[model samples]
Target: MKASFAKFVILFTVLAVAGFSFYFLSSREEPSSLCPQARTTVSAPEKDARMKNILAPTEENIQAGKALFNSQAQPIPCSICHGFKGDSIGVIFQWIKPYARNFTCFQTMKDISDGQMFWVIRNGSHGTRMQAYKKLEDEQIWQLVLYLRSFSE
Candidate 1:
């Protein structure tokens, strides 16, 4: 009986520890890092018709963006690369070159215009793991841009 009781106690302890570990790790809101200086002044192509944020930074739009970032993005989800919190340290961070874009870096985001962000989201960066989210709708992309910008703010 004593041996059985000891085993039960050990199992309970292990289960408790695992449960807490999962809760703490998953509950983390965002990761903070010192971002490198970037050329934030990327200009939007004049010919691109959707060069502005049509949707306001309302809760609904931001929520929609969050949803898209988490699951709805085509090719691959944004959270897989940019992180669920837009912190750049995503699940595939090790495999990506030059690292993912850290949307939380206010210094870099400060100079990047809404139009520039829209262009990047639609066209993707040329030399990075960021592929063009061409499958996403224009409005959906705009909502995502807004959600990403919130990371810096």
Candidate 2:
């Protein structure tokens, strides 16, 4: 009887260890670069024919956009949802069902035009965590667009 009890205990211990090992191994970090980018069927509203990027993609403009994306000055910094790397793996994405946009994916971003992106930024995307940056000037949004374009490049 003792031998049977000892065998049962040993089997249980082995099973528990194997279960834990599998769980931990599967939980390893998944880089955002490898994750699938956000795929949206929703069409961005058309932009005004005259609307265009007022700020050139200069070093200063890019820096300003980067700062805004990382800072909480206005619109609470895009990094909160888009991630610091613009890979859309922000901390807030955990609660968001669809997740945020992964800008690194060229396939998804190729279809998005500058004007469409600008409109989305200025007027938040529907059914997503994105919020409208009505407080930010158009030029500031354009600067952010310029910064976002770099992620795919």
Candidate 3:
């Protein structure tokens, strides 16, 4: 009986160690498979710098923007998570775990500047559910960005 009990203890220890090792190994893979980019900043497309010329989100632009943002361009209704006006969730989560930023809040919006928002929307946030829309047309993305500006006001 004693011998049998000793064998059970050894088996249990071996199983526990194997289980933990498997968990650790699998967890090390990271959320994304792509290798890390050396640069810390987001890069721009190889197009005309005219992308910068677009400013002023007019009412007509806003209306157009709204359509662009709401459309099923990818998978989700951006406003659903960002809030109706996009003004509460914030662009970055300060303390919350994987927080979805509220887009309607203008205070945070102004801080990001147009370029940053365009990059994030186009590239999507890594380590999060945000997926880059590399396929979206430049005009469509601009329109969406214009609509997003309305949330800041």
The per-prediction tally of clashing pairs is 0, 0, 11
Rank candidates by TM-score, best first.
2, 1, 3
Q: Output the better candidate (1/3) by TM-score.
A: 1
What's model 1's overall lDDT? 0.80
Candidate 1 Cα misplacement greater than 4 A, ranges = 1-34, 37-43, 46-50
Residues 1-153 of candidate 3 have per-residue lDDT tens digits of: 999999999999999999988865654422122122122333445352224627466677678778766655667656545534453232232322344545544444445556666777788877765567787777767777887766656
| Per-residue error (Å), model 2, residue 111 | 0.8
TM-score of each: 0.71, 0.72, 0.55
Compose the digit string of candidate 2's lDDT tens values, residues 1-153.
999999999999999999988865565346554455546636665554236677788999888889888894384888987889988768665556567777777878877778877887777778877777889888888888889988998
Roughly what TM-score does model 2 have, to 2 decimal places?
A: 0.72
Clashes of 3: 11
Worst 10 residues of 2 by lDDT: 41-50
Off by over 4 Å in 3: 1-56, 88-96
Q: In model 1, where is the ten-residue run with the lowest total lDDT?
A: 33-42
Model 2 residue 63 distance off true place after TM-score fit, in angstroms: 0.4
For all the candidates, what are their Cα RMSDs to the real structure? 7.1, 6.6, 10.4
Model 1, 1-153: lDDT tens digits are 999999999999999999988876765443443374344334667655346688999999999999999988888999998888787878876566667778888877777778878888888878778778888898999899889989989
lDDT score of residue 1 within candidate 1? 100
Task: Please estimate how well model 3 matches the true structure, expressed as its whole-model Cα lDDT.
Answer: 0.58
